[model samples]
Target: VAGQAAANQVFNSAFWVTSFLPAVTATLIAKEKAQGNEDGVQDAVCQAIFVGVFIALVTTALCFAKPNQILSSVLSQDAPAMEYARPYLLVRTFAFVPSLISLVGFSAFRGVL
Candidate 1:
């Protein structure tokens, strides 16, 4: 569970930061709507999604490439938990993108609404 916790911390930090994307998207969409530009609204959503995806991809890559480094930083290298955390984090990387995308989708939905 330590590993998952560590991974979640990373994800949560990301969630907090990217959480602004939806608001920005919504604001942009509203502005576009006021200007009568449908394409701009689509562009805003696409841009927000792209940013979210990009961050997720980078995070996934980092987790995949350096699970040890990550866990070591969050947890002591000599800790017994490191062994389990490493493998768990590696496996957990798979969910990163989808998790972030879903968040973006939810936020975007709210924005659009």
Candidate 2:
């Protein structure tokens, strides 16, 4: 029960971060396309990819470095839950980059379409 709860907390946090990727990417792409700047569109997509990957890398490092502090702040005072969440959080952080990139790609496609 504790572990599952912890995992859910970690997943939810990461999901929140990823959820904005599509909106951001879509906005960037649309703005660039509206200006009729082909280069701008490419630049926006590239920037999105780079920024997403950078964010993921930073997030992963932070979670791995300070899992206890992060989990503690977000989760309850349950030690066992925190312990279980730490590893799960660390693992989930790895998905951030790819997930963000895919979202951005989808957004770009929608903009183009």
Candidate 3:
């Protein structure tokens, strides 16, 4: 759902995703056979990627939004780290929508029916 909304905004590709399930199935099936997963590896990859991206976004925000003093005490003494993290977090937050689309679109194709 999130992917669908974001894709609609970023490109008119949501319709294409909906229509592209058969190709997705063919590719995923080949991958699954290669990987030896009878249980559907595509769903597993999608869920894992979603969780990974979510964790990354959360960690980025936590480090960036909190104070330097807290971050320093918790992570490292390098001021440069926090400085670097600030922009990184902002970019990651903004990137959520696009990354979300790619992640979700690939996963969505598996269960598209």
Candidate 4:
């Protein structure tokens, strides 16, 4: 759903967000099991946000705001795909905010350990 110029942003963002969850969970569980630091909430949250906000504001915003007409310009004359892309992209864009909160919260959860 991301355009050419925004590819790296999307890729990097996806990398961080995806990799973060498992890593955080694993680290948190390990730290808890080992009775490690429980005061890293701010740092963890800041890190998660550092990774997410750029992609959310730039790439996701573009996808949501791109015109339905632009689909014709960007994609081949595939009517069915365009029809679905529009709404799906919009939905994903709109959901990005809340989803981000949840994801960041999950990351923060790890910090509590």
Candidate 5:
């Protein structure tokens, strides 16, 4: 339970960005397309992809560096499962970038279509 909770915390931290990136990407691309600017649409997609990947990478690195701190905060310092949660959280962090980027890509596609 503690391990799963900790993993959720780490992913949730990045999830907020995921929730909003789509809106930003979709809006930018839609606006550009409405104006008939293919270059601007491409630029918007690229920028959103870059930002999403960058944020995910940074989040993963931070989780890797401070898994204990994250677990402690989410599971409480006295939580007995902190030790177990640490590894679980680290493992889960690896998926952050890929998931985020995939969502961003979908958003871009939705925008284009």
Candidate 6:
């Protein structure tokens, strides 16, 4: 039970890192559109995607490199939950880039609307 709780907390916290992407995407689109540069909007979207992927990659690398430390900081070092949560967190980190890209896409669509 403790392990599950810890895992859930870790999972939820990690998602916070991706939460800013939508706002960023929307801002980028709006900026480009206001400047009357449709091409620039597309370019900005591409750049945003690249940036998101890069950040995810860095995050993944860090998580992999220091899973124990991260888990400990988030929970207790000896928490049974850390065992379950660490692997889940590592696996989830891989989804960040793709998820962020999708978010950016949605944001772009929202901007259009």
lDDT string, candidate 2, 3-94, tens digits: 65776676667667767777888888898899999999999889878877787778778878887777776676667677677777777767
List where candidate 1 sits over 4 angstroms from the true fold: none
The residue-by-residue lDDT of candidate 5 on 1-113, one tens digit each, is 86677767767866775688999899999999889999999999999999999988888888898877766666876777786788788888888888988988999888888
Global Cα lDDT for candidate 4? 0.53
Q: Give candidate 3 regions above 4 Å deviation.
A: 1-39, 67-70, 74-113
TM-score of 4: 0.53
- Sequence-dependent TM-score of model 6: 0.81
Could you estimate the TM-score for every candidate? 0.82, 0.80, 0.34, 0.53, 0.89, 0.81
Best by lDDT: 5
Q: Scored by CA lDDT, what does every candidate get?
A: 0.75, 0.77, 0.47, 0.53, 0.83, 0.76
Which of the two, 2 or 5, has more TM-score? 5
Query: For residue 86, what is the lDDT in candidate 6?
Result: 79
- lDDT winner between candidates 3 and 4: 4
- Residue-by-residue lDDT tens digits, candidate 1, 1-113: 77668766665665576677767777777788778887887887788779888988998898888877777767888877777777777777788778777876776666555
Task: Evaluate model 2: give its lDDT.
Answer: 0.77
**What digit string (tens of lDDT, one per residue) describes model 3 on residues 22-98?**
35544665577567776776664465555545654664455456634333443354644555544443443455545
Residue 34 lDDT (model 5): 88
Estimate, for each residue in 71-104, the C-alpha lDDT of model 6 and write its tens digit.
7766878876778877777787677677777878
Alpha-carbon RMSD to native, per candidate: 2.0, 2.2, 12.2, 6.8, 1.5, 2.1
lDDT of 4 by residue, 1-113 (tens): 34432333333443355555546644654455456544454454565666566656765656656635445455454555565556655554565655666676775665455
Clashing pairs in 6: 3-81
Sort by TM-score, best first.
Answer: 5, 1, 6, 2, 4, 3
lDDT of 5 at 112: 85
